[model samples]
Each structure stands twice: as structure tokens, then as C-alpha cells.
Target chain A: MSGVWGHSGNIEPMFQSATAEAVEERLQRPRGWNRRNSLPYTLVFLIVAYLGVFILFPIAQQFLTSFSNNVVGVDKVTWVGLRNYERLFEDDDFWFAVQVTFTYMVFVVAGAVSLGLVAALLLNRKFRGRNLARSAIAVPWAFPEISAVLVFLWMCNPTFGVLNIFARLFPGIDANLNWLSDPNLAMPLVIALSIWKAFPFTFLVILAALQAIPREIYEAAEVDGANPLQALRHITIPEITPTLLLMAVLMSIFSFKQFTLIWLTTGGGPYGGITETLVLRIYQTAFRFFDLAYGATLGVSGFVIVLGLTLLFVYAQQRQDRARRR
Target chain B: MNRPGNGLLLPRSLSMGRRDFLKRTAAAGFAAALATPALAQNAKIKIPLVSWMWNEPGRGDAWRAILAKFHAEQSDVFIEEAGAPFNEFTNNMLIQSQSGKINGALFHTTPDLVVRLLRGGHLEPLQDIVDKLGIGDKLSAAHDHLRIDGKVHGLDIVTVKFGLLYNSAMFEKAGLGAPASVEEWVETSTALTKSPDQFGIYSPHLMSEPGDFWFILQQWAVMFDGVWAEGRKPQVNTAPVIEGLKLFKTMYDKAMPKGTDTATANQMYANGRIGQQLIVSAAVNIWSSSGPDIYPSLRSVVPPGPSGKAITRIHPICVNAHASDDEKAAAKLFVEWLYKPENYQELMERCLDVVPPYPEAIRQEYLDKQFWAEGYLAGKSITPLEIMGDYIFFNQEFGNVVMDKFSEVLVANRPVEDAMADAQQELEKASERLFEGFTL
Candidate 1:
């Protein structure tokens, strides 16, 4: 029957196209939309207005005020043309800040993702107390940022901290490190804390992607005489590739905006601790210094930097996808 | 003890509007109120303070203590103080303002960006009320920071300042007396830094504007020979200033710790590696209170620069221009009461690190135990007015740039003079732009 009168197939492209056209027409029909159904549009309008007034407007106000020529201590603002930007350019601290923040973002994002992937792979397999362990792993994420930081701080306290106690007990660690005070150690410690706090998020996402992998593919690989280590190499990585790409893009943004842990734990100590990220600097500039113009300029640069990195990631993925599709 | 008691008092009658509860009076006549009036009055004043809950005495304790006392003074009106955390104070204040739950707020200093509140017309002006109460002159005569635009808006019940604290042992070792002139100070600094164990000076060369940079720079600029205009515009290129920078550079090159930088000072100091710190006199108590290992053998002195005239920065308690009328009135009373010698003493005792904001408030305890009194008194003035003959306005924004730029130019190997000139230009622009036309 020539596959039920199909053009070399049972499925008819014409019918599918015709049905899609009918639905499109029905959707676009002016009279078909119930005039009484105004709730959806009203909801949309309200959401936009709410965001504009509360969130968007404040952001715009900050951008505008950053350009202000108002005197310090007096709240009166006037637009100053690029003076803030010019000042920021010459400011030595600004350049150093740029270097510190960019470095933190690079290291944290790369390090966290790498470690997260490894942790995800470990947890992906079945083991005794795997369920309990999976739940236990998320405990760090459950603690509030400040509370977790407080505990971490107590652990890191130079004089009588638990970590120091351990160091002393072991007699292996030479001298107790002042985790909060030493500039050399502070940023890396913050990065460590951030990674600890953040990896759980990546783990959850990766686990989901790992679980969604078809069991049969692995069975097929095994049937083809693929070894456990070899099958895992080919089967696991390709399956969760999309999720890994999306997470890299998303977490890169998160690391760029990672301020609170640093703000609370260190408050950008050690005279602008190795800890002040772009977000911290922007916050201090905009809120503390009240240099909205310079703040905006820094913010814009931060935005460009973050967006460029994210786009590069996305573009790379898109190109890879296209190459595979081709 | 850190947790507050769960308690509330009802006035004698609920038959009236909630707003009218202020009129309800206790049965005790004025004479009867005198004996145990505090307890009864505390049971009555319906005012409550929203504050932060912390272990060490933060700014909230000062406010809480004042409110607790106010409750005793006004038996008919009770003041209840509740606290959250400092991190959430602003957000909580915003929410409270929205719900109109705030009777008044307790703050150490007026918030910087109060324009939003002023725009909302949340603050009540105290001019007319001050005139009626006849407390205006009494308050400002003691605390000048209360006036905004010649009108009263905020008040400081307590204040503090950074005073140069030195290691007298180091001074003795160097066989150098405190320098009264720029030349003497530079020479002293150069000699003191011959080794790693000691430093001639240890001050933040860079800081956020409106920070300690102004204090450090004030000590330097005046002695080194720099000046600013009526607008607080700094003239850094002057010969004295150049001489000062040259000395500072020489100190940087020959004397000061080779590895000194913004990011390393705390560690360096904690390691018992620095000799001088221009700490707030308040830190004298903290230093004494701290564990001996972390604490350095400390003494206090002002920068004996070339001018021999010592100048430092002040953390003045200013009034928020947006406080409501009743708030303004209550706040005025608060400020006045705080300045009363007894109340001032109580405040200093509670704040621990802080001394009374005014020189008039200084007493035997401050003189004997207080670092500023023990150390930095160079022809003491009773109030800040005495210091004003040698004053430079602290610009928070400009100070921020100075600190930032200073560290960059020096630690990061940028040219010192170029960094200074660039810093001044940036800060001046910031001062111009951030503070366009303040008549003050």
C-alpha cells in the first residue's frame, strides 16, 4: 500500500503543515479572543509596571545619579559629563580592583565547575547511604549565607578557631593561618567558601542531567564490549553536555556577582582585601562613597565583562552544536 | 541578657483613639512622680525603638540605653526597643516606614542617602518646634552637627575621632622626641625605619573618601605645606606639599617597611610588625581590652608634623533632615540629654571605645583612661571649635579615591607624584560632582 499512501512514509507533511496553519489562523482570529478575558494582559501590564517602578526605575535612577555633579554630603545631583569615568580611569585602586575581581571570577567559575563535575560523577553512582549522602551534601546550601559564614569564620578564627585547633592537634601545620587577616590567604579562602557554597547547586543540576541519561545506551556500550571506565568516558560526558554548557554560562554570571560572602566574611578587609569583587567595589562606590557616576561606569564595565564572557561560552556551544548538526 | 524582655504596657484607658493615648496620664501627681517616676513613666511612654541585636555594644545599644532611660522619664509614654541585625537595618527601616510603624529611629549617624525619605516627606522639620521649645540654641551650642541648612534635622548623642597613637618605646629607642615641625618629623620617621621590627609611620596611605585618609592627609598636608579652598578643593602641588611628598617618598624608599601595602597592613600589624597607627582614640580601650598577643604595646600622640599643629578627623553625629516633628522633638530632647555631663558620661561608659564627641564632655575618666586625653592633647580645646583653627573638611568620596590611588601608586609601583596629582584631580571632580552646591 506504499506505506498507506504516504510519499515514501506513513506521515504526511502536507497534513501536518495544514493543521499548523489552521491553528495559527485560529490563534490570530480577532473575534475568537474573548473580550472578557482581559486578566492575562492586565497581569502582564501590572508585572511590567511593578518591575519598572520598583526595580528598573531604581536601577535607572542609580545610573543617572552616578553622573551627578552634586556636592558630597548634600544630596542635590547634577549631571557631570564623563568626569566620573575619567576619574575611575586614573584611580590606581580601580585598576587593581579590576584585576582582583576578574581573577576571582575566572578562578572560582573554573574551579567550582571542575570540582562540581567531579563530585557529580562520584554521587552519580550507587553506593551504601547514597540517598542519605545525596541529601547530606545539600546541607551547605541550606544554611543562610551569613550563618554559614559565621560558622566558617569561627572555624577560621586565628586565636581559638576550630580549624586552628585541628592544626595544633595535628602538629603537622606549622603556624596557624589567619584566614581572615592575611591578604594572601583571604581571597583564596573566600573562593573556597564560595565554591563550597556553590558546588551543591551545580551538583543538583548535574545529577538531574545524569539521571535523565538512558540506561540502554550504557547497556548497548557494555554489549559492544566497552569497559566500565571506557563506557563512562563516552556515555556520560555526551549525555550531560547540554546541562554542563548551560551551567557554565549561568554560574559564570553568579561568580561575577558573588559579593555577599565576601561582604560579610571579610567586608573587603585588609584595606580592600584581595576579596573585593567588582560587585563589592560597585556597592562601596555607589552606596558608601556615593559616587553614583563612577559606580555606574564600573557597573557598566562589569556588565560588559560578564556578558562578553557568557556570550563567548554560548557562542562556543552554538558553534559546536552547528558543527555536529552539519 | 542579650535578648530583650517580652513586655508591653497598656495605658489606663482604651476608650480613645490610638493616637490619643499620649494624653492619658498616670494617677501620680508631679510630686508623687518624682520618687519612683522612672518605673511608672517607663510603663507609660508608648514609644518603641527598632534596632539591631548584637553581642558587642554596636550603635543600637546607645539608642536602646537612651530609650530605656526615656521610658523612666516619661511615665505615661513607654519606649520599647527591638532589634534585628545591622545588615538588615536599612531594609527593615524601609519596611517600617512603609507601614508607618516607626515612631522614631535610633541611629549612630544620619544615613548618607536620606533624599528618598526627604522626597517622601517622612521627616518633619524642627525649626518651628525648636523655636517653641527654646531647646534649639542649647542643643546646637553643644552639638553643631544637628543643623542642616540652618535648620535642625538630626542630632548626635555621642561621637568619636581618630587620634594618632604611637609606640613610645620606639620613640625612646630612636632617641627622638616627637617632631613639632615637618622637617623633624620626616627625620624621625627615616631613623625609626632602619629595620623590619619598627616603622616610623603606619597609616593608610589610601582610603575610601570620607574615610580616615582625610585625617592622615590633614596631618600631612598642613605640615608638608598644602592647602584647600573654600570648597574643600585641595591644592596638592604647592611647594610645602611637594616637600611633604618628597619626604614621604624618601620615607617610603629608605625607612618604612618594604612590603607595606593596603592589603598587608592588618596582617603586618597583627604579626607585631608595625610601630605607629593613627587609630581612633576609641581603639585605646579596645587595645587595652584585647588579648595581649594580638595587642601591641601602644601609646598615643598626634602627628608632630612641621607645622607642630595637630589636626585629625571627626565622626560628627548629624541629624537626618527627614525626621517627623514628634521625632525631631524627641530627638532634640535626646541630644540635649546626651550632652548633659552625667548622660554624656553614661554614654561614654556604655560605648566603651567612644569618648564624648565634644571637648567640653571630656572629664577625669577621659583624661586619665582616654587615649586622646592621655596621648594626643596638644594645647587642648574644649570642643571641636578649638580644632577648627586648623581644619580641613573630610570628604568621604575624595578620601576613598585618595586611599585607593595611594595604594595603587605606591604599592603597585605607580609614580607617587603622578598618583597624587591624578588622585586630587579625580577627587576634586568627585567633590565637584558629588557635592555640586552645598552652602555648608
Candidate 2:
């Protein structure tokens, strides 16, 4: 009986020793040369290659194009290094568009994240028809952008738009306001539409993060005589802070690149470029004016801005990782 | 292999060794490979004739019918319709030109786009076709811009001249006749307007539709005998141009649908809610179909201002220079056939077009039948080249600067003089970089 038990234990050690030897052999080999390690490296190479072709290549081309005199119908295309950049520096419209982009980004990010957080907190509570509420909140995220723009155009129509009815309900308002055409209201209305379209995505992400929190933490806080608000302030918020930071970075990116909603709504005008962002400016320069070199210069500037956003995202992810470890 | 539902069963006699099977397959494939190009050569060369008119309502059907006729009469070539909507077509073509080749073997270009394409050398000179057709001496003055180095690169297919197209029923109901001067025009328009229910006039003022706005905006200055530029020098700050902008503002405030888009404005015009539109002659065909009730009552007149001149823009059909030699030859053949006196007359009639590309393109009898033809013909024809001057190549860019500043005049009630002054400065600065390395 003793011999039988010893033989079984020896078989387990033998299996362990064989696996350890294989691992040690792998470690002894030079990095990235082992046959087994090639799978991950190959996968990584594929991802990097894909990004290089589709993303980095275009960016490199645009950077090169920025230094050329490449306007359509020009007699010849030649390098005019720094001339485009000098023009960009002096361009009033480009600066105005930059200012508009930042304004739009700040408003949309703050509006989306705060609204999403509030909605997520409310929906986090157990209640009747909670599933229906959760599904209902995601509808805007599912709606197509072009379809939304068309519906928004109809709703803002001065003559027959349903928005006019609501405006008329106000005390001082007697006539239908020119909603999109009024320069004062155009930016605000465009921002509102963007928020409506964008908030649902943030809401979903925040809700997922909220659900991931353990119920025991809350139960423990309640046992310590902490009220709902205190528990929310100490437990809920601290847990979700990383997610909120991540969402802010993502929403900033989203609003930074928003084009179709604002374009189809106001076309960067009721007068002037009251709502024009850098993307629209880039399009107007390249496509409308056929000033490809200047457009490319604007594109390079936009790339720098996107690079900054990527760094912000990386920092946020690192912070989230640190928090998770704690 | 003979099992049910497994695969097709080959007869034992038809079965072959692997090497024999491979050889037979290779021989059959070789024969197909050899025969493919021969078969293709015998088939009609299908060439796409790209034009925004293919997407237009009545114009689309008219062009398709003309294509069918051309197909019926031909054996060596077939023409197919290809194009985007009007708003996108010019930009699409421009992008194609930038890429060193246009998409189709043939394409129609707007008045401005034709100049750009000609300068880019994307158009094969159609002088031979015009000369072969014997219409060279009779081409309209609007075709002047299509000429380069004494060779015509394109042939005019449609000439849309601006005019005051109005719903006569609305004017009749309001007891008004067409105004002969600017003051009367404003008074008549204001009197006809009943806000929210009716608008007396509409000229695209919204920045959202810059193409239509700028295109028609050029004509407003023309109404006052003003040219936007003269030999690459902007004349936006001139008195006539200012007056023209002021007139537009007055009409916008008191008469026009303040913020209406072109589509909605057209709908309003069709319903008799809009009295007048300072639009092109080609638009009449659209109204004839969309607004059948008002179509019979529609009449056009010389726009009311000091100048009776209207901008006559010729859209030309050109063969793509970059197309294969075979495709180019086939496309030119279609162009020649389409430009034949009889075919051209039939096309003009079907399109409800009054303007003839030449003296003989439209029969006098047919011209006499079009009641809407008088105002368009009576108005002096001012080609875009004459107005835009050397800036003809940079028309949209020049127009954008003017439009942007003038938009303030309409929306924020900025003084026209101040706005035009700013536009003049902007245009002067832009001209430094705009005409570099290019000759008129």
C-alpha cells in the first residue's frame, strides 16, 4: 500500500519536472527566437502592420504633402517648405476654427460625462422596469447619424418645426425663432444635438463600470452607519473615478472629431463660421477650394492634437490599472 | 461518388485519369483565355457619359431616352449613364481630375468646372467634333470660355441663363405685373408677401447651400450691371455691387422666406406660396413637373434692375483626355451624333430648353412655341468669363470670400459697405496666392 501511494506522488512530480524543464529551456533561448513565442509576436506584428498601412501611412503622406504647392490646376507642384505653415499661422479662420473646436470639445465632454454619470447612478439602483430603462437609454447610441441629422433638421425648421411650438410656450416668445439660422443659437443647438447623440455611449460605459463594483463594499459601508450619500461619495465615486477619467478622454476624442452633425445642421454658418470646427475647415479647404497643400497642413496640426489625446488616454489607462492594483 | 445527395455521378466512360483531366481542363482554359479578348473586341464598347443631368428629374429621363436613341442607331458603341447629384458632381469630378484621371470616358462640366478641367488638361479638345459637325462657326458666345489655344476642348450641351421666373398666378392674384426697376421690384415683392403663408421671392441666402447661393448671387450683381471681378481684380466694393447686396437684404427682410432652403422654397413656389425666384432657365423644367398646377402660369422676365443682362452659363460635355484611345473615339462619336442639328433640336425640345447652342440647334418654330423663351432671349447674355475675368479659374474661391462677408450683411445686419470693404481686402490678399504660376 505504501509503495502504491509513493508511485502516484512520484508520477505527479515527474509531470511537474517535465513542464519546468520545458519552461527553463524556453527561458534559456534568446528572446523572440523560440517557436512557441512566435505566435504573440506574429499577432503583434500583424496589428502594427495593419495600423502602419491604414493610419500611419496616410499621416506620413499628409505631412509630406503639407510642404508642397499642390493646389489643383496649379501649373506645377513643387516643394514650398514652411510656406503653408506660415500661412496657417496668419490665417484668421484657422485660428477661429481652432477656438471653436476647443469650445465644442470642452462643452461636449463635460456635458456628456456629467450627464452620463448622473444617469448611470440613477439606473444603478434596483428598481422595477430597470431593464427597459437600460435599453431605452441606449437608443440614441443605436440611431444612425444621417437619419438623426435629417430628423433634427426637420425639428428645427423655422416654419413648421416642432421646436417652434415649444419656443412659443415661453412667456416672451410670440413668433417662431429661426433656430439654426440664428447665429446665437446655432452653436448651442449643434452642441445639444451632439450631446444627445454622444451621451448614450458614455452612459453605457459608465453603467457597465457601475455594475462591476461589488455589492459587498456597499453593504459594508451601510453596516458602518454610512448613509447612501456618504457611501456614494466614498465608495461609489472613488471606484468609478478611473472610469470617469477614461470616459472624459474618450468623449473629448469623439467631440474633437465630430463633423457630420454640425456640418449638416449649420454648415459652419448662419453667418461666418460660428460653428465651424477644424475638420470642416480642412474639408472646405481641400474639397471646396481645392487647396490640397493648405488642407494637408491643417491635417498635420489635427494629427498633433490627436496625439495629445492619445497620451491622455494612455495616462488614464495607467491610472485605472494602478487603482485596480490598489 | 454515386451515393445519393453526395455529389454528381460521372459515367464510367466519361471518367478520366488525373493527368488527362488536367490536360483537358488546361486546354479548355487556354481556349477561353484566347477567345475572351476577341469576344470583347466584337462587343460594343460601353462608355459611361457622366453628367449630373442623369440624376435630375425630367432631364434624367430625357437624357436616358436620347441615349436609347443613340444606342438604337449605333453598333460600335454603347453609352451608359453615370454621375452624382449636381451638388456633389463638380467636387467629385474635380477630385478625379486631381488624381490624374477622370472616372468616365465622357463627362459634363459646369461653367466654372470646365475652365478648371481645361486648364488641368483633363479634357480632349472637341474642336474636331464641332468642326466635323459643321457647327463651329455658329457656337454661342457662352462657349468662348471652352476654347483654349484656338481649340474647343468641350461642346456646350446645356446653356442655363438666369432670369426672373415667377408664378404669374400669384402676381395676378396680387394685381402686380413684372417690375421694370429695382424700387418697384422691392415694392411689388413686399406687397405680395404674406408672412408664414406666402413669400414674394427667394434667392438662396443660406450659407448651407453655398453653391446655389454663390451661383445666383453673381447674377444679382449682374442685375445692376456689376461685374464681381475684372481681370483678377475684385470689384466687390464697387457701388453697383453694394447696391445689389442691399437690394438682396431689403428683399430678404420684407419679401423672401427668411431662412428657407432651396428644396423647401421650391416646394413653396410649387404650391403658389412663393411668387418669384431669381433662378436659371433650366429650373423651369423641374417646376413644370413638380408644380404642374403653377407650371402653366409660370412666366420669366428680365430681372428688374439697371442692367437687363443675365449670366448665361454653358455646361459642356467633354471627352476625358485620360480615357483609353478606343473609349475616347467612341465617346466623340456619341458627342457628334448628339450634336447633329436634328438630334440637338429634339434634345432641346424634350428638355424644355430655350437656349440653343448654335443658331441652327433649335428650330425657330420650336422656339416660337416656348412662351417662357422671350425674357431669356430678350435679356443680354453675359458669359461668366466676361464677368469673372481672369478669376474665372478661381470663381468659387472668389465667390466664397464675397459670400462670407455678404452673409454678415444678411444675418447680422452688417452694413454692406463695411462687409464689401472687408471682402475686397480678403480678395486682394487671396489673389496673391491664387493666380500664381497660372495664366488667364
lDDT of all predictions: 0.58, 0.87
lDDT for position B358 in model 1: 43
TM-score of each: 0.62, 0.89
Model 2 TM-score is: 0.89
- Model 2 lDDT tens row, B1-440: 44333376766657778998999999999999999988976798988999998788888889988888998997899888899998899888887887788999999888878888888889999899888888788899888888888788988888899889888888888899988889899998999989879988999887777788899999999999999999979999999898899999999989988777788788899999999999888888887888889998988889888899999998899999999999999999999999999999989989999989998899999988877767887889999988888888777778878888888888788999999999999999999888777675
lDDT, model 1, position A74: 37
lDDT of 1 by residue, B1-440 (tens): 13233453444343456556544444335446676766655544333344443333444565568657755665544445654565555445444444443435433322232333433334444455456545555553434433457775444443344455666656776687766555676687777774545567666443222244454554455543345333455555456655555665566655555433333554555545555665555555444444245444466555545443443333333233345545444554555555566666666666654444444454665567543344455422123333222112334444455555555544445666776787668656655544444444
Worst 10 residues of 2 chain B by lDDT: B1-10
Chain A accuracy of model 1 expressed as TM-score: 0.83
Task: Give the C-alpha miss distance for residue A192 in model 2, angstroms.
Answer: 1.2
i-RMSD values for every candidate model: 8.2, 1.7
Q: Which stretches of candidate 1 lie over 4 Å from their true place?
A: A1-108, A118-204, A207-216, A222-234, A260-278, A292-326, B1-107, B110-156, B166-232, B237-276, B291-298, B309-324, B349-372, B379-394, B413-415, B428-440
Question: Candidate 2 on A1-326: residue-level lDDT in tens?
Answer: 12222233333432466687656743454443434446799999999999999998988989998999888876567899999999999999999999999999999999999999999999988999998998999898899998998889878888778899999999999988988888899999999999999998989999999999999999998899999999989999888888888888889888988989987788788767899899989988888888889999999899889789879788768977887799
